[model samples]
Target: MSGIATYRHTQKAPLGLLVYAVAIGMFLGAWFTDLQSVSLILALVGALILILGSAFQQLTVEDEDDQIAIRFGPLPLFRKSVRYDDITDVEVGRTTFIEGWGIHMSPRGGLVWNLWGRDCVVLKLRNSVLRVGTDDAENLASFVNKRLQTEERE
Candidate 1:
């Protein structure tokens, strides 16, 4: 583990997020009749959109010495690490739009750490599953697989 080669992948916020934010604002403004409250609500919603767009905008995958670490951008609140010994299998998979973003439990089972996109690296752990959404799904899966192989030899 001393000379371990680390692999990292980062995802940035896509343009679609801005569009979504605008849609939310429009809907909120239309639903509320009070001009003062509507303005306040709009500001709050705008701030929320900015926070979500920036705070949870990125996902980083790292191959540490003996574990794979996944981090959601700028926020320490959504970081997780799984040791090689605990991972049973890793594969490239797809997630439906219904799954959405942020750190949450996937309907399919286990947790899903996604920033954007449907491509993901699904990890089957000893007792549970974890899906890490990434644009480079194949490379992430291969990286994990290689690490697992190396760990098995040791």
Candidate 2:
């Protein structure tokens, strides 16, 4: 892994998300003394947010050997790798907000592994397509293209 060229991208938690988390915590604290049922509900919602937020905290793109690897973190909930030989094309593209986030099937066909953002690098493989969301969409696509060219030469 030391020699491999890795492009790591991570998104800082948005201010809005932080504010929402705080609000949830405040509500839970305030209701703890009075309403047990309401406190339990808020606790569950807060837990869900914490879980999802941690899962979408970062994205990493790596070029290793002859394969392109993409991973979402701070948890390894979604990860994928495609060999240069298997990829037909790589293009920088955009994803609609409607597509949401996480690992999902794109409406246009293919799997989308995203943390949070519209910019993406789409990979057309021999059998299926894969979209990876990243802030450096162009750079990622260019890196993949260069890898494919090198693979073809060797």
Model 2 — which ten-residue stretch has the worst lDDT?
Answer: 7-16
- Give me the displacement of residue 111 in model 1, in angstroms: 1.4
Candidate 1: residue 120 Cα off by (Å): 0.9
TM-score for each of the candidates: 0.79, 0.79
Give the total clashing residue pairs for model 1: 0
Q: What are the Cα lDDT values of the candidates? A: 0.82, 0.75
Any runs in candidate 2 off by more than 4 Å, and if so which? 1-6, 11-33
Predicted structure 2, TM vs. truth: 0.79
**Which candidate achieves the best lDDT against the true structure?**
1
Off by over 4 Å in 1: 16-40
